[model samples]
Target: MVGLRVLTCGFAAAALSVAGCSATGTTGTTPSGRQATTSNPAPGSPSTASPADLARKQASAAYVGMWRDVAEAAKTSDWRSPILSRHATGDALSVISRSMYADHRNGLVAKGAPKTYPKAISADPSAGPTTVMISDCGDSTNWLKYRKDTGELADDTPGGRRAITAEVKKAAGGWKVARFAVEAVGSC
Candidate 1:
């Protein structure tokens, strides 16, 4: 039952994150960088993005960007605080929420990430709607801290690895999370 609850909570968190982006009908992005357009329209015309392509880009950017932040946030239990303060409603909230879920799983580990942490997340810009949802599958070195009966702080040196997937969406504010799933890889 406890395991079910944990899984349910994780999925619920993913769903909520996705909903934020879907509800607002927005995509998150700074107006500065220009993304490459897919289909070429005319010789002299500016190439424009199809709704589908735009969605994928939005989700990919949001999801990938969030993953980068997750590692940093794990250092502080309140990683989502900065995201919330930014008023990250739709896609942004989804991304962060999903990341928090993933991070929590890592926190359960005993040992920390390997000294040479392997971190990598992939974004496939070739999938989904007016907002794209990318999958981030990768591994990392993580550390887990716990207290023993001795009343002193003890740390587990498990080099936990992970395979994580995230779905992002486009929101009015920017990109946000649509879904997130993660599985610990190998032995700790």
Candidate 2:
């Protein structure tokens, strides 16, 4: 069912670093707060965003961007692809790499055109690298599965909504996904 697809997307999301993102969709909110996805003040324009607000937004975008990229990588099984490696680490990486291998072996892959509307973005400033929680209206309406290398497309499926939590930490480089999880939700 759609619910399982949503969960699978989440699993891949953690693995590939993104599972939902649609540029055409409207805005959304989450329990943590909506500031994460709020419209950004134009660069160089005088703004009222506190330092914390700006940090939250940047972190949120990075986290959400991971899902978007992961979803797009459905057709590919190279879990170590540059994009996925940049966002995922630890168990998340293991899961995604293993799953992709399985998909390749079974000749199956998913195409979940995830359109994520991040409803909430919250971060703990005191935490190192900052811990962030992103709840989004995960709308994967064009979601589908396919027979890999065969181009056999399946039915159109939709992932209603999903709550994703990721613990992001600052490494020698930029932010990295230490751990993350996805859960199905009845509403955004």
Candidate 3:
């Protein structure tokens, strides 16, 4: 049950850009930290985002990118790569990294790969800007796995979606994934 929940390809990840909300800083951090300040200096009005929402979206996008890379690495049985170091740290890395290693040893690998799209995003309002607890939901239905040598299907998780809750922390350079919880969801 745990393995099935953890390993799924149906997740989407990318960068952040809202139609009205302009980005203030390079690392997804706003100086004020009270609200999402916009770079849109229009005469009439501007958009504002809750700091927690912004933080979660940014971190979730980063996680999807990192997980995608991790999937690609599985094709060649390469688990230890620099991408892991760049995007994530702590238990998040530990869980996925170890899982991939075991999968390789067991001769089971993902088949089609993970395809993710953001479904919902939210963050804890009580948390500060630098550190926010984020829960992200997405559709990963296209993600499936199979055996490497025998050409047999390994897992085709029901519904094909993934939901993750993560803690994203702002470092000196940019946002890094502190950790995350991955689970196979019923729907996107």
Candidate 4:
């Protein structure tokens, strides 16, 4: 009888210790006290990211790429630069811009169109892949050079600088330009 009591106490103590470890989420004995959870990860323990998340990321990337293109076009004074016309489709489509506007003031200069130092800067945020908008200031006005000079040239300085705003949309195959606008900002 005494030997049996000693054996029972030893087994109970060991079981209690394992229970404590399990409560702390450590690898420890199972309730039956025959097995313990292990540190080794189960098969496919790490789940894959969802498709929606991937699409959103792609959209963000496309938008950034398009913005870079627009900035590059501005620096180079080229309205026809390819960067301004990127498009994407599906989830990626949301990332590309559909419409964009350029200040035609400088484009006019490139085309040898005559104009005052400061010109009426305009935007074209409405042009999509299937639709294109042309300058409306009549044939006498130049459409080549987007109005890069602000109205600041008046007192021997340039006029207000202009900025372009774009609207983007996803398309069937890729992305499309949806809208464009030009805003005049401060005197140059």
Best by lDDT: 3
Count of steric clashes across candidates, in order: 31, 9, 6, 45
Candidate 4 TM-score versus the reference: 0.31
Each candidate structure's TM-score, on Cα atoms with residue i matched to residue i, is 0.45, 0.63, 0.63, 0.31
Q: For candidate 3, what is the TM-score?
A: 0.63
Candidate 2, backbone clash total: 9
Residues 1-75, candidate 1: write the lDDT tens digits.
001011111332121122112111234445777553343343222234444444544555555555444434444
Every candidate's CA RMSD: 12.6, 12.0, 10.1, 27.9
On TM-score, the candidate that comes out on top is 2
Candidate 1 residue 170 C-alpha distance from true site, Å: 2.3
Q: lDDT of candidate 4 vs native?
A: 0.29
lDDT string for model 2 (1-188, tens) is 21123333333222212122222223667787764455654432226444444445555666666666566565565555667767666665566666666666767767656666653245555333255455555665566667777768644444555555565555556655556656654544
- Evaluated at residue 70, the lDDT of candidate 3 is 64
What is the lDDT for 139 in model 3?
Answer: 50
Instruction: Give candidate 2's error at residue 122 in angstroms.
Output: 2.6
Q: Write the per-residue lDDT of candidate 3 for residues 1-188, one digit (tens) a residue.
A: 11325643333333333222343432344677755534443322233555555565566566666667666666644567667656666666676677777877877766445655432243444354565454456454555556778866676544355566556666676666666666657633
Candidate 3 error regions (>4 Å): 1-4, 7-57, 117-128, 156-159
Angstrom error of the Cα, residue 173, model 4: value is 4.6
